[model samples]
Target: MKKPFNSKLFFFILATLFGVILSLPTFLQTQGPKIILGLDLQGGLNLLLGVKSEEAIKVRYATLASALNHYSIEEQILLDKLVVGEDNLSFELLDSNEKSKIDKYLSQQEGLEIVEKDLQYTLALSANEKINLENFAIEQAIGNIRNRLDQFGLSEPSVIKQGSDTILVQLPGIKTQEEEQRALDLISKGGHLQMMAVDEARNARVATMSEREAQSYGDVILPFINNPQQTILLKAIPILDGSMLTDARAAYDNNGQPIINFTLNSQGGKIFADFSGKNVGNRMAVVLDGKVYSAPVIRERIGGGSGQISGGFSVSEASDIAIALRSGALPAPIFLLEKRSVGPSLGADSIRASLIALISGAVLVILFMVFYYGIAGVIANLAMVVNILLVVAVMALFGATLTLPGMAGIILTVGMAVDANVIINERIREGFRAGENFIKSMENGYMNASRAIFDSNLTSLIAAVLLYVFGTGAIKGFAITMSIGIIASVITAIVGTHGIFRFLQNSIMKSGNYALWFGYKQQVYKRKL
Candidate 1:
């Protein structure tokens, strides 16, 4: 016969496990951990931009249009014929009949610099420049896509350019799907970003509407420069325009006021400088669509020729404005390509399936423990409950999103968590039958089990870590949940199970209740009568 194991140890282990588990939520959620949110769990928006080849071709022709216009070249007179083909632009000189007139006209265009080679007049457009313009437009489209996403107020959005003509946008955790889609749809429209005169009456500028009215507009669009007279409304055209801006930045003036600084490309610079020189002291408005972004008073001939638009802005706001300008406005109207919604019913189904899997797994394990080890199996079952409670608490504290894959990890941990306890309990029972005292048997059991426990767990942990490193999205979620659960299980098994047994040992000593606990007496083991 064997003395029953100590109840004091069991209670202590139970208390310690429960206490730690209960406190985990507090520890993890103290400052709100970086918990992952799924696209469905956090209803947000997704935008896929299909860049039309036609749009790019149209833009190319538009650039050619501007070039022709700049030289005062009559489209019909100088250009013999214009043929806008699908993938190429072809034009013949009107006076192929007059070689002298064509030569003289080509001489006046500064950068166009056409040269006659092998009897064919070829415009010397730099290959690099053409490539750069194409790349720049694509980049600008990317920028516009980003701005549109920002307007939706989604935190940590994923927006990137996919090819020369495609953009992919994923905004997780957005509040309204419709609003997010609406904002993104507006992006491909590429609303105009222009400089226009501020229409005082039409402008949403008033000294002091009621505080409520003021609040309604969320912060009135303030002027970049304090001037009432010159307000140009910068805007975007329905057709693709304004590829002229080469660079833009944020800086401070001589008085140290925040300002948006911009310079057009050489061709655009020529036009801007000329415009500034002619419109000196007039009000030039920077407009986007129909809204006034900045209205600056043209002080002097701005030929040298970069100009600044100063406004009352914090550093962040100014940087955003600068980025918006550099990125260029959106182009071509956009339509919603796709829309999706994940109802709560699906989420409920996920939760239900997860719970069923976990419970089914746990129940089978508990049944096996009881059938195999009898009384010791009961203790292990109780410990399993404690383990699960702790895992839940830790998850709540960490604010971890419980995805279906994460649920699988939790259930897997439940099975593995009790393996160490099973090893040690079986070892101790065998030691008792082999003529060892309680303390000796218990010490030997844990000491011998440590290596096997450690070896198995370390291997599991390594696998979990590797999964976490390589996996993305849902796979990563599983890895994280498994890793955390495994760690918690090891801790609870070693320290937690030890505490439970220790309390049991102490209780047996105090109450002389070993027989009741283990279902055997010391006398019954003797003399084999």
Candidate 2:
């Protein structure tokens, strides 16, 4: 007689225990499994952003112009007619014979193509360099948005590159309109911060003169946030920008007003310390997104790479500023191509409908199985229950998101799980009709049916893998649940049901009663030789 406690039974019991333990956290509402619901299931914000690649190119050119301006002054190179155009930089050489000298200087600069025409040189980014810059901008934008979202406390956000110059952002579980707006504003804001010395003389002149007149004097006018009528003219050169910031946090000032305190990196610290030490008592404009937040005069040489931006801001505003500052600036501005908000009520309806469909399908499958195979059917039903449990447990264990399609996959699995049992039962019935003993017929049923079951399930598993690799969000969810279900079905339908049959045969069922339990009649067949 076969032992009641065989290796297959032992494995089935061990797997069931492990799966139950893994699934316990989900049932008990504890902090074990970190499974997150998808955006469709939880209701959240979805934003599609288009990166302004052209603007990125322009910004790169402007930065290069700044570098050239600095080099010209430091190296005593007379670069005349320096024009920072929209798409390229153009400059005239001081001497036509000095073309070789300028070429040597420019050869050291990377990502640039220099062209000479009639003693005038134009510099633009190479084609490959432009593509690389655009790609980098998109990548950096994703990273910046992710950092901001992390600080904003939204969990399990999906921020990925959708296309060449577009990004897809999904913030799960955000239901409120205020929250939606806040998240959108937080992400869309460019957050370009710069510290430039306030040009008081130019400011006074700009008040009396035209806007173009101030530009002629190498000044840029930015309006104050608190008082838009009041504007400050800042030097064209900035002392430091947000890229130098290492950390930022929200804090309360002496008067209990919210403020953002920031720390700069080592290089920024040295530059800021030097600039502040030499320009004590001079006002410096704190500009963010082209708007002046504050203009404070330096009281002393501010060292330690630390400073504060204090304005009449609310606590939430201060927090937003801190998050933006800490996350650094986006490489270029983003345009909101599409915006969508999913309400919790809609998600709730989806969940209810999905649950109904799943339960209805499972119940129907269970009833059909019980009606067709009788005692064997009951055993299959038990295995099906275990199969579902193992599927959920695996999903929870892997922290995979559950979606509406995933529910459909589970429903489909119920039918597939029963199919394996049906194959085995039919094979066993065939063996019985051929006048085989109960033990020999049952063993033959499992062994003969195993090949077909393995082949079918193996093909399904391969399809699931391919779907997961190439499919999008919801499709990937379906593939994941389907893969887990297929694996669980194989274990339950074969090992789980076979172990139960072994136990029944070894411990409960008598050899003579096998035909009655198996729901088949033993028939002697004559073979013609």
Candidate 3:
């Protein structure tokens, strides 16, 4: 007789069929959504870095000095000297008449302390503002590092804070030394950009003058990036800096040499236009991290806030620098505290060991279930198999990363999935011992088992969610797989196995073979109320 249309059975078959199809990419390397192996499962680079928040404050001070210098030039304020002190700035105003103009500008700025004594003005960052800036720098650095790694097309890169001032980074598929070095360079690149005018009058003495002597003349000495042996002198104050930069990308120059094309925001554009328009026939140095990359003479007024950096770069170098610039400069320098690399062989061994443990446990569970419960155990084995498949299928569909800890979660899931079936089987055997018929015994078995299964699964899912929220990297991976497994087990164990019992209810009843199906001897038990 045809079994009446059963929704539970239909859903079981539908879910099983979909799991197989959706998991094909992960199982067979087909063209579809697939799970990605993380750092522990695939070779990669790991780094621990400490952010120098103090240096960030210094960078902030230098930027402020540049702004003040630009303000002086814009307002035609003469200054005998403008110096950026370690924690404060001191400048001597040549004209006391324009002091009111400078005072108005300072008043408009926030988080600053200013004082005036005769022709001298002092400016410093407030104590509370200093702490805030330091904290902001660390947070900003983390964001910039993550952004740069994402642009590299890496799969599942991990970037997170470890402590108050430290960052942890993991990259999944860096196999060769070259790839590792490239990533390290990109991560550690300061990316500080500045546009300073060449000190034309004193630049001729750059090759002969000491840094101290150069600074005394209100000039700074820097080496060309393409030729470090060739030193140049530049004005201490910048015409503009990267704070106004909006976009940068790797491109080729006329000679097909690699270069980085950059675009600036409106403020920077006007500054570039104003500086170039007024300083025609003079040279401006394009400096990055205090090293001059290029010094080009201003031919005419350059507009549109666009410029390019040419340093005789290779394609990869240019691309990396472009990514750094595009992501915005790191607020502070990060020092590498530790470096470690995991090899492919180690990853392979981990995979092999995890598989061995998983297969061994599953096989033992299958054997025990079949031996103890006979045919009823076979029904559970079917649900158990589908449960495992569904777990992998869901993870593949979501493109989740699988780490070693995640493999352990799956192994634990195998045991948990079978535990539910075991409860149902034991409940049915108890029903038989109590003199119940086949159909009624099966109904009582599921009814008793479902509550216990639901409660356990719900508690486990809650724990998994908490782990995901508070844990980082590998812990999160484990929680993710464990959570998916819990949901899959509920569907295949309680719902799927119950559907199977309903579908075969008639066949077993006609045979009257309780002993063979359930490992129980009803003939030995007395009928009771």
Candidate 4:
């Protein structure tokens, strides 16, 4: 005769499975699985950008100012006021003299039609023009941020413009996190490089060259400022600049020193080759954000078009520089105003809190189960452990990022998953009270509970799906995890619990241990009317 299955023994095996599956993330993460880290888990910078609509309007008005100057009709024109209506920008230009000619010239510009009456000429944009301008500025801003983040070597950073002007950047995992903000600042600077004549004789006079001579001999490159002193000659006119670079990596030079290797696209290659060939023996500067990073004297033409920039750099620094250069520069400067790092102390607190919550909740559930149905509750609790194991295995399989909210979802799911088994077990207890045999009652309980279990979990699964569809990062994470748990609960409750129960039933029948399988020692409490 087969011996009845021990509930304690079942729980031990289930626990082992749970432990193995839960450990998968740690093992995979240790092996560098490239899992996405949240901002809280990995320290990084957060930048809040406020788009200057007035500033954009000022630039547009400045263009008008320039156009007025170009036409040689300058009468100390003052943009008396810029009234920003809901649809367009209305500028009140007040200039007593040359007002008629200036108004005529401005009206000639297609989108910038003007209304000239007396001394005040109201210059306003059409509805479509205003919308187009706003869209173009926003697109430019977004592209700039994208380029900056790319240069900073942030992998898959999130850059979304919230309203008309606010940009939300969420970079989950970034090395040297400070570099993120620094790169943003540099890109915004809009620096450039320039070429200048070198005051030096041939090789014979090299030893006598002054500091100023050496600096000029290389290239008089300077940062691009609102008012710059000089303009350096570009090696290439950037036929296709940062937009064309497919990939960039850092490697060692022949001397085993750090260098950045970059590859340009087909069009970029041709432009680079043509420029390099034409500019042999001339010095060209590699400018980024208006600053000259390196100025190499061209010896020969490079046409096949892949090149390396070798500066005296450490390995880590070389890699970082290469990453930043490859990613396009930012359009506007961004400052890191706020930073908060997640310390190990906070992580420890979270872990302890989670443990306490899990233990307390599990104890309550176990007590409720035991008091309600005695031995049957113990079996269901054993199944709950397996449910958790299945959830973890699924998590490992999908590789979902787990947040604190997701952990809460997991803990909450533990109780909910067991509720399914509890319902089925209680139904079996009722069948036993109705004078059915152990095996018959078990089958009846499962069959009756199957519909309720499926319907209940299915409804929750739908809600989870909807939440995932509409929710943002963290909430979506919670919904996804809860959904997985619900699905796992259904399978473990219906299949796992039934399988264990059936296995125990068969053993009890063979070994004459019916009381052990059915919890016949427990009595049902009747309600007093």
Candidate 5:
């Protein structure tokens, strides 16, 4: 009755081989595990950023005021004392008759409500408009930060919104303080780059004008990044901005110094070509966050929309700038509310402690199983080892990240695996007391014990799924490992251990030995026919 080729045995062998192959890279120390380690385990930066929502509101009003200025010039309306407030823009009409005209202009605008009181006209966003604007700003900030991180080349970063105006960032495996700061700078920089024409006449006249007097001319004087003492006068209206950029990268200049090379979209390309073609000799300032990085003269019409920003930058600085530029600007400024860096040495210590706990737990479990059930216990111990290997291999295959909590999950799985063997071995002892033959007793034990095993693991799997859905960071890591471990345990307990018992049964039958290895005395009792 011995079968030469058993499907269950074949499956068990194949799965073990697959698990070994999947885990070989990590075992050999040739390469790291396919599963990544989280920030807590690997050591990196954790940042909490609060978005300046008021800044977004201010920028919105500034843009509206610029539009209103254009309308006033075009319509030839004389308005006085224009004021920009936190939520509204107000102006007084010199003539009351112009109220109707202003009302008509405001009615045409979307998301704006016009109000008139005491000859003062106020334009403000409606309630829905305010909510929409705030949400849009937050969503835009998230998108911009994700793009920046992607370009910065960090793998498996967690960039998520913590609350209405807060963002949580966790970057794993960053080792140096300089690198961490560089990443923080790249994420928070607004990166509002602009190309503006230099105003030579105003530049000369601004030397005599007071700061307040110079502001009335609607021109901005910004210091150069390389030489802060030297300043340039640029028109407030930009000829081009970062919004039109399509790509940017870091490159070396002719002198081997680092610079950022950028390209524009088709429309921006045509605009630059037209502007540079007409003003070939004038200097166009490359401004970023109100600081002029460079002001190069137009030698010829730069038709390709390609340009470089060079200002004595190191390689890493230039690379950061290029990444920020390519990712676009944040909708609003982000202030760091809290920052914590985990040192790699601490992470190493943690790993050491977790490994010690795991090895000690596994050794104790293996010894107990072997001492309790004799040969059957040894089979279960073997299955437990395979269970752990398969769990790790599954994690590697799925590219899951492991954390301290995840290591705890694995240890818990070892106990769960032993639980399965205990159930089956106890059922086998009961069947032996009922006077069943070796093969029949083993068959009944596996059949009767599998139902309880399936039900318990099923409920645990459901809980793991819920945890994964609702948890964050390390909790999620725990859920993922626990989930994978549960599945691997079921396979190893039912299929792997059973296959070994089947092989043992065949060998015992051939040797004419009907000894029970269930660690219990057999009783001569009548079978319930």
Candidate 6:
């Protein structure tokens, strides 16, 4: 003697209504969390980039050389020979007294193999260390590229490792050439900011000095960013690098030109203060990737960990640089192995095809359920619709991307959504033939069908989880949609349908018509002598 619609049904209806509300913004293209179309579903740039991981080893070697050179100058240790080899650097100590200092420096280093014959020492990376560095370079490149894309305000850009030495990048909504070029530059920007002293004693003769002569004097000739024809000679060793940068932003200067303002971490702040305090009246060149942006004379101590780079950049260029700096430098340079731009028209065609397939599949499933199960089939169809809505609503709530493969997953789920109800309906039909009451029949039906539904959905969920964990790009998208769809189907087809049947149970029992309610004829008993 319960109400026609019980509290269970009320809660079920509320959940469906909540799903509808959550999905509305996405379907209507309004604000709030919405599903993003993937590269195949929307026009975008697809790139296969090869990371030059080998260059990482060279960079490490060069870094060691720089550190050694800087230490020699700081400690005033004379050296007879200082040469950077292809795999290592070799230097001979001219003063025997400095051997202890050099040995201590070598001890503090992390990964290096050193050989000494009298005063000359050779240093190189161990085989395992080199291999590890190369592998780390690839991972670091992927992380940096993803971080840059995320900060560039691009929507759901895909950056994944394709293989041991390559990356696959999918940037959605990059239609124009300008956008593509900007994205390319942003991803490739090394962001190797260095602050080097402008070798004041020899800078005056930079125009006439040869490259070899500058190297002999521990200086490097770098071109100016604004005018590449002009060059400045800076000390080879950098006083500071971008490794310490905590944040960077594009801002306008007093002259209305765009500039990059940056902040540094605690260690960098202390170094900046000490250097500026001591180097007053000396120029310090702001170098980035072998190009000097500015060389301003340090007039007084600069503190607070803040600095600016002024290079006459446009707003867009400045913004890109700022984003790159904030995202950190790539461990190695990446070259484009392949580039493909997906056209919007192609995406339109794909979307149309996918929609046609999904709708067609769902319609056929809905019709089959209605035809076979009759009134009970109608309830199952209702559950299928609610299941689909919940899947979409949850994906939109999470801002997940929708790809073509993902659409295919939803289509597959549509056909599978009513499976639980199919089992339950058959069980109840069997009960009706065995002379069971309407309420007891449904209760037995659900109880018997529960295990099958649980086992099937549980196995499917496990597969989806594995697919998500090990699969890449499109496979991951497919896995996500299928996972969501399966969970929603369990809720709608199993739990929701049971509640709905309970809500309609009293009417069916009072009507005493199993044929209309369950699409089956009831057996009539005749008295016999």
Model 6: per-residue lDDT, tens digit, 16-54?
A: 997898888888988877889999988899999998998
Question: Candidate 1's C-alpha lDDT?
Answer: 0.58
- Order the candidate numbers by TM-score, best to worst: 6, 3, 2, 5, 4, 1
The full ranking of all candidates by lDDT, starting with the best, is: 3, 6, 2, 5, 4, 1
Show the colliding residue pairs in model 3.
none
lDDT of 5 by residue, 1-529 (tens): 5564567778888888878888776557556557777787889998999988667776666557655654664576877756666688877788777777777777888898888888788888888877777777778888889888878888678888886789899999888978888889899888877788898677876556565554455566788998887887876556777778899899998889898999999867876887788889888999887789998888988888899999898898888888888888776899999999988788788889999999999999988886677678888888888888888888887767788999999888889887898999888778767777667877899999999999999999999999999987778888888898889878888888787778777665454333335553443434333
How well is each residue in 379-475 modelled by candidate 3, as lDDT tens digits?
8888888988898999988888899999999999989888999999889878878888767787898999899989999999999999999999899
Q: Write down the lDDT that model 2 would get.
A: 0.82
Q: Rate the local accuracy (lDDT) of all candidates.
A: 0.58, 0.82, 0.89, 0.59, 0.80, 0.87
Per-residue lDDT value at 28 in model 2: 80
- Model 3: number of backbone collisions: 0
Question: Quick one: RMSD of model 3?
Answer: 3.0
Q: Is candidate 2 or candidate 4 better by TM-score?
A: 2
In every candidate, how many clashes are there?
Answer: 38, 0, 0, 11, 0, 0
Say which candidate scores most in lDDT.
3
Per-residue C-alpha lDDT of model 1 across residues 423-510, encoded as one tens digit per residue: 8876776666676666666678888887888898889889999997876546666887788777766666766676666656655445
Between candidates 3 and 4, the one scoring higher on lDDT is: 3
- After TM-score superposition, the amount by which residue 420's alpha carbon in candidate 1 deviates from its true location, in angstroms, is 2.6
TM-scores for candidates 1 onward, in order: 0.52, 0.84, 0.90, 0.65, 0.82, 0.94
After the best TM-score superposition of candidate 2, give how far the Cα of residue 418 lies from its true spot, in angstroms.
Answer: 2.8
Q: Alpha carbon lDDT of residue 100, candidate 3?
A: 89
Whose TM-score is higher: candidate 1's or candidate 2's?
A: 2
